[model samples]
Target chain A: MTMALAGWLSREAAVIAVPVISLAFGCLVGYLAQRSGFCSIGGFRDFFLFRHTRLLKGYAALVIGAFAAFLVFWLATPAAFEHFPWALTSGLSPVPGAPAGLEAAAYIVLAVIGGIGVGIIGVLLGGCPLRQLTMTSEGNLKALFFVIGMAIGSVIFSALVQGWVVSVMKGIAW
Target chain B: MNKEPEERTSARALAKTPVFVGALVGILAAAVQGLLASAGGPEAYGFCVACHTRDLVNSAVNALAGTSLTVAPISKNAVLPFLTIVGVLIGALAAARVNGEFRVKKGSLTSYAWYAAGGVLFMVFALLMGGCPYRVALRVGYIDIVAVIGLAGIVAGIIAGTKIAVACVERGE
Candidate 1:
């Protein structure tokens, strides 16, 4: 349905409007998340370290809210069903003609490895990315540095490592 | 003469009101966001952390090239999220003012460096997976099973990470 709306709207409007909505959505989520103390990393950390579940409750609420909303949207809109066309494929699938399934698996493996690294770093850094953003919005200068680092790293990845990154990602599962 | 009890009562009342207001604000903000997204605003995401992170990336890339790059179509839909961030700042500030919890705190150099490293790791993983943990949860809510798998991986990683952090702290690192 979102795609359909994108098609219905002029290309310019769709391009402009979609991001506006996306940003708005992010800001709101960040705000609510900060206010509610919803940090998944913190949740796990607190639970494992201190056997506290207060933070975990926030994470649970977020998941529940998201699931309920998703269900209602899926049921209400036929177009939403169309969005999950690739829901059942195993391993990783390429952009059709790019590589074998193994290559896609490689990407997932890299992602997982990277995910682990992110988790460790999040623990050391005092928050996950979402938490960092929320903390930054709440005027924590420390989180601002993390956000800056993310932007810099992403640019560096795109500029220098795009092909290597894609290839390694492709090669692993294959 | 009898100001102590009165002050304590006022403080308790003040604390209770903001908690109530914050909860209402949060739920209302979330519901509004869901409604907008449900009205065909986006796919598997009415709110996306990864996409905004990507937007920041895209913006940086464009700035580097000495050309003003346009915001992507997907990113334009981030209204409530942005406002929410602003609202969060206001809320935090207000709470701090009322409760006197505001203070300037700094971390050690090691902690700062670790934060930078963590930021890089988060960016790389987020780009690869096409979302962050929040987005992963949102994806699951949308019944995207891939996101569910990713969330599982995240949990596993978090557990391992917690163990490592505990070890490091114990070792005085």
Candidate 2:
């Protein structure tokens, strides 16, 4: 599966390009997010609680926009999207972020577990991670703590939780 | 003159709406993949708050302490870890400062502690699902069924969280 990017950089050059590209894109998204108060979890919460569509529209648009953009890019550069329509090609297998060696059922369970955790925490905290990040920048001390916790959590996750979760799953024959 | 000014202000406000921001994020996510897939991929390797944070921290730890902490292959092969989260911090800070919204709001110690704990737990669960809400959107856009399931789980979680929050409020805690 030979993949090619439409970027001007070659594979060797891409190594250096990664951080630069990612950083620039991140800044743009961050700025927009702060200005817009975008929050995915909040979107769902509002709709469910108050029948408000203002924020919900944003979340729905994100999904639709992503699909439209991916389709366009896939058309323009088919090589870049080896599995353009992931469901058709990969079927039940995921996009490779969970602990590997697990079956589809295990991955589904992880997804549900992770998603529920994220959603509940996000709602209780008043926003999603992006919103917390932006609020931290806006001088919200609570949001700042959340960001700090995430940093600490990341290390702990890599060093401990990841192994523990994988082992536990294996133990359960998942 | 007043009417014209109000109309112009409304136009500006439209640009600041979340719908616009969400669309921008989606398009840019695709752009990231289109431009950077050559570097390496797990595909849908686009915008994700949780995974990117994980990449940044783990990679930094690996460098500073010589620990072999795991990170995404894209971040691992790159000359530097993905700096998206750092960029987000800087960008949001800049936006806040420019808009005169950067106030130093303080919180109680206990509140801070809870937030910090929440952050840790959120990161763990988000990673367990593979990415944050944003990444789930991107993955679903890419037509990943697991992400769809994750989305369903998020909805279920939200319902439960809302119920819990309401209960807490009713108890006057």
Candidate 3:
């Protein structure tokens, strides 16, 4: 449907419009998310700190709703999962299990480190990327600074820390 | 204080419900993000906050410095007049306008440092994780097992952070 619509417009317009359309989708989602008070860390934090589950229910809704949407889209077009397509217990699949050998161990370690790191920071900052965007849009200086830090951190990771990470992984194997 | 008329719209009334609003946004996000994911768009490109926004900032920095230090791909080649972040900003701006929720508050430098530190932690480790918390959900929707593991870690980390927050609140007493 999107491609078909894009075909009518000029090439340049189509190119320019896709990202905008994508952002528009994100915008609607972000706006709705903010208005509804759905946040990533807020959900878990509420459940933990206040024993509140309203936000957690929102989180659950996000998960189940998004998963069902993905399944529907996927059933129509299986190629979207080409990078790492979902398997329905297809025993002859190539994707490795998480409990395997050294590579699996490395994945586990990285996944653990990555999740804990983002989770803590997300809780501290009071929002994830989506929430941050909402805050920044509302002209929150703190959110903007957090974004600045994110930019710096991303640059540092790409330019320097990525190499260090590779070395650390190599060391783990050695 | 009586609010502005637009601020009291039916949309706002409907949005107060977490489950309904959440499901609507989820379905909306998933439709675009999931389809694009298969249509050969960027990885998790639909609604990634860190990657898209960071890429925009990086491009601006590079342009100002007269360098092209692209550590990742961007939507520059697309026909959009600006980065996707711009779209988000506009969307958010509009929402804030409607909700009358725009506010700019700066905290003490100590808090700024704390917030920035948290940002660093988030962006740095998210790169390692290959996605942020939302992206983790997106990946899990695709049945990526690695993301499921990351979700566990996120739970643990949230628990740890919650404990710390509680401790700090108690200490302030």
Q: After superposition, which runs of candidate 3 have C-alpha atoms over 4 Å from their true positions?
A: A1-17, A83-104, B1-10, B34-44, B59-82
Best by DockQ: 2
Task: Give each model's clash number.
Answer: 39, 0, 4
TM-score of chain B of each: 0.63, 0.91, 0.75
The full ranking of all candidates by lDDT, starting with the best, is: 2, 3, 1
- Say which prediction, candidate 1 or candidate 2, comes out ahead on lDDT: 2
Report the lDDT of model 1 for residue B103: 56
Tens-place lDDT per residue, model 3, B1-173, is: 98787876765777777787666666666566443432234433445566665566656766687755443432445433225566666777778877788888777888778777777778888877666777676666656677788889998999998888788889999
Across residues B68-132, which tens digit of lDDT does each residue of candidate 2 receive?
87798878888987889988888889889988989999999999999999999999999888999
Q: Report how far residue A98 has shifted in candidate 3, in Å.
A: 16
What's the lDDT of the predicted structure labeled candidate 3?
0.65
Q: In candidate 1, which residue ranges exceed 4 Å CA deviation?
A: A1-16, A19-27, A84-104, A171-173, B1-42, B63-73, B76-102, B108-110
Stretch of 10 with least lDDT, candidate 1 chain A: A91-100
